[model samples]
Target: MLPFQLAEIVNQGKLVSDEIIINLLSRRLEEGEEKGELGFILDGFPRTMRQAEILEGVTNIDLVINLKLREEALVARCLGRRMCSQCGENFNVASIDIEGENGGAPMYLPPLLPPPQCESKLITRADDTEEVVKNRLRVYHDLTEPVEGFYKARQKLLEFNIPGGISESWRKLLEALNIEDSDNMRSAAA
Candidate 1:
């Protein structure tokens, strides 16, 4: 099972000990290795130096994408974010264009939204509130920021600006990974 799945199990009604977290994560890493998986992405794990050390023992990590954003923008982006209730599609309210508005209003869907429709209203996540987001950011700075330096010293960090937009950053990531043509990168695999 994936580490996140193990995390969900650990998070159910109790706090998971660091030993348990490390064991579960190590097992998942081993499973991925046995299956010959490449370019594994571990989102929101290894928040501590110990965890990073354990990961170093398990396998080599190729790239680390550190998204840099201003604290104000981080809060605003989290506040303006919305998700599809049915399909779990994420969209930012700021990125969507409103129809017949004077450019200050936020809309759930962009003007000239394509069919077929989602039907469900885009809803804000419970954890997206100001207080919760601020706390999360605080925790990140306290626990996770050190990991960036850890990887940076190893020459594996790629810091990207969020205001540059995801698509542009995505292309930069492709370049970082030495992927010349992202379109053909997948087809070549198949």
Candidate 2:
């Protein structure tokens, strides 16, 4: 698996430790810069303030979008996630329960939402379990809060609160980012 191979490389270790990925990324940027493309979007990378500084030195981040949802809300939303076994659709248990999933405590178990598309194959990730998700969130808060602050101090951050529902939340998110049309997003994703 890709993760397994990454583990081998990580375990083998090198003189460069935490910044190894950044070094590789800078190499990638150099390659992309040679092309006519505008630039690259680095998501889930540069997690630390140091990494942010390193990135700032290389290029300007036009917008740093932050989803400002309460931790309890996030925990509920994340802990209640259920996905189709064959297809990769995320259904929020805190809001709309899927039709099939039976995970989490009785108080927390969310109803499964059937696959959005008729394509039948859906699966939940192993790490989506409650304990794993809770720990993941704790780590996320610890790591990402600083990254958020890093941008906040530079006034490069744009935050959008999660609205009352998914539909509204997504609409607000796009509005915060100034995305005027969904067609462009769908086409880009496609």
Q: Candidate 2: list runs displaced more than 4 Å.
A: 5-17, 82-112, 116-121, 182-190
Question: 74-180 in candidate 1: lDDT tens per residue?
Answer: 67777777777777777676543233337533322222222245535677766677787787778668877789899899998888654345655567667766778
What overall lDDT goes with each candidate model?
Answer: 0.67, 0.64
lDDT of 2: 0.64
Q: Candidate 1 has which clashing residue pairs, if any?
A: none
| Model 1: CA > 4 A from native | 1-17, 96-116, 184-190
lDDT at residue 149 of model 2 (Cα atoms)? 88
Q: Could you give candidate 2's per-residue lDDT for residues 147-177 as a string of tens digits?
A: 9988888898887665456566667677877
What TM-score would you give candidate 2 relative to the actual structure? Answer: 0.65
Q: After superposition, how far is residue 97 of candidate 2 from its true place, in Å?
A: 10
TM-score of 1: 0.68
> What value of lDDT does candidate 1 attain over all alpha carbons?
0.67
**What are the C-alpha RMSDs, in order, of all predicted structures?**
7.0, 7.9
